[model samples]
Target: MGAAGQPWSYIQRFPTEAGVPRTYELPVAAFQPVGMRMDPAPQAPAALDPSIITEVSVFILDKQQGPFAITITGIDAES
Candidate 1:
């Protein structure tokens, strides 16, 4: 399910340093075909500039029968 809001515009509020516009696209997990047992290939992560990212946000736009969660992790210790 894709979002309907203009969440991408939020990136404009950050300190990009660069004058050009930018976009942030979330990667959706892959779905396997029937009778397939092997795991799908891994994907390269988005190249993000840490110094420009000050905050993040998530939104659940539609109604759901059960609770949902979004977890953000895996930051470098040196940061």
Candidate 2:
């Protein structure tokens, strides 16, 4: 999926609605954790919500230009 040139951010959290997902860009810096203090400060603090979390994605909020490189670990396919 692609988006229109949004500035880089960190720790974007989402909520699920009836098995559907809602997505948005966090206004915080690209280095701040969701639950910790953010630069320029958000009105409300952030935290992880596990109940309605169906999927969580860690990605750069930039245009999905080609030739992207990503690496993920902590897998147990044999289980």
Candidate 3:
């Protein structure tokens, strides 16, 4: 899907529920591995629940700044 003229998409797992929807703001520049810190300053962080992140999936979107990937890290809910 496209948000605010920007190309974006989302992944939804099974067993949906009706609870307070949460929003996390992850910078498009901070999806690198822990050892790969290109910039001296910190990059954008993800908004996923700390207890539910197990794996991360990256998606690339076409933009003027070239293609950018948004990584969605899965967290463990049993924290």
Cα-based lDDT for every prediction: 0.32, 0.36, 0.32
| Candidate 1 local lDDT, 1-79, one digit each (tens) | 1122312212111222234544444322221111112223233122333444444444454455666554445433234
Worst 10 residues of 3 by lDDT: 1-10
Worst 10 residues of 1 by lDDT: 30-39
- How many clashing residue pairs appear in each of the predictions shown? 0, 0, 9
Residue 74 displacement in candidate 2 (angstroms): 2.4
1-79: candidate 2 lDDT, tens digit per residue: 1112322223544432344433444432333333223243243234323332333355544555756554445422121
| Model 1: residues with Cα > 4 Å off, grouped in runs | 1-54, 74-79
- Sorted by TM-score, highest first, which candidate order results? 2, 1, 3
Model with the higher TM-score, candidate 1 or 2: 2
**Candidate 3 lDDT by residue in tens digits, 1-79:** 1123212222332221235344454543333222122232223232223333444444332234743333335533332
Best by lDDT: 2
